[model samples]
Target: SQKIEQNSEALNIQEGKTATLTCNYTNYSPAYLQWYRQDPGRGPVFLLLIRENEKEKRKERLKVTFDTTLKQSLFHITASQPADSATYLCAPDPNSGYALNFGKGTSLLVTP
Candidate 1:
């Protein structure tokens, strides 16, 4: 069976600093990985996605890296603001079915 893991504890960062989050998986080779941001009481919003062959991807202040060999992915937020505080989740496309399996998310808190 495949398993995905993320930090269960909340991350605290000062405003304007970069926040780095991680996702790890085992027993599965996914075609792609996706990152999403979810605010309190709201659904997750897609942030980025990287394919198995892609080394890295970026959008504005966000960046994502996928390492198929290591079975891991990294998510980064640069110059993060208080508004950037939210729970971040990583989901790998199982490719076996239409549904996506998401890892436990990590919460981020940015303070001024």
Candidate 2:
């Protein structure tokens, strides 16, 4: 009984601004959490992976924080550009090397 919720509405922002997105879940005994970016009509590409024991992780222009206590994960993109516009997904990995069950991603739209 796991639930993941991201902004179903597209996030519209001006270029060069940071965009923050939230992912919330419940009833999942997760061992790890991961973030992915997906362009329209394309498969999701993994961005960050954080174990349940981890507090934060970062890669390039993206940052992710996982709080098992809150059963939530926050994804951030800094100095974002129009090229950054895409859907972002968060899925949990229960430490079994099993595939993460993903929710509908949050769409981001950056305006130049």
Candidate 3:
């Protein structure tokens, strides 16, 4: 069986700093990785995706890096603000013809 792991602790960062989160998996090689942001009660909003063959992907103030060999993925948010606060989730698609399996998300709080 495959498993995904993320930091259980909530992260607190000052506004305008970069926030980094981590996700790790085992027992499977996914075809792609997807990231999302979830507020207190809302569904997750898609952030970015990185293919197995791709090393990194980026959007405006966000960046994601996938290392297949290491079985790890890192998510980054640059110039983070209070509005960026949310729980970040990672889903890795195992290419097993099933839907994405999401990991326990890490919470981030950007304080002013």
Candidate 4:
């Protein structure tokens, strides 16, 4: 069985600072890992995806890293703002064969 784990607690950070989030998985080696940001009452917005062969990926102020050996992925928000506050979800696709199952997500609160 494949399982994804993320910090269930809310992460609070001051605006203009960098925020880091972690996602861990067990029982599977995924071909790629994806990160998404979800606002209240809305679907998650795709952020970044890093493949197994790739070490890191970045888009705008977002960055993601994939480590197959550790079975983990790290998500970072550089120079975060209050508007960047949202629940971030991680989905690890096993061999790109099965459906994408997202984790419970870790909420980020960027305050002024």
Candidate 4 stretches greater than 4 Å from native: none
Model 2 agreement with the true structure over 1-112: per-residue lDDT tens digits: 6688888888999999999999988877788888888987888998889888879888899989999888889999999999999999999874466666887889999999
Per-residue lDDT of model 4, residues 1-112, tens digit only:
7799999899999999999999999987788889999999999998888899999998999989999999999999999999999999999986656578999999999999
Candidate number of the best lDDT: 3
Clashes of each: 0, 0, 0, 0
TM-score for every candidate vs. truth?
Answer: 0.96, 0.92, 0.96, 0.95
Ranking by lDDT: 3, 1, 4, 2
lDDT of 1: 0.93
Count backbone overlaps in model 3.
0
- How far does residue 25 in candidate 4 sit from its true spot (Å)? 0.2
Query: In angstroms, how far off is 67's CA in candidate 4?
Result: 0.7
lDDT of 4 at 35: 94
lDDT of 3 by residue, 1-112 (tens): 7899999999999999999999999987888999999999899999999999899999999999999999999999999999999999999987788768799999999999
Candidates' lDDT values, in order?
A: 0.93, 0.87, 0.94, 0.93
List CA RMSD, all candidates: 0.8, 1.4, 0.8, 1.0
Task: Encode model 1's per-residue lDDT on 1-111: one tens digit a residue.
Answer: 889999889999999999999999998789999999999999999888899989999999999999988889999999999999999999998879887989989999999
Candidate 4 TM-score versus the reference: 0.95
What order do you get sorting by TM-score, best first?
Answer: 3, 1, 4, 2
Query: Comparing candidate 1 with candidate 2, which one achieves the higher TM-score?
Result: 1
lDDT of 4: 0.93
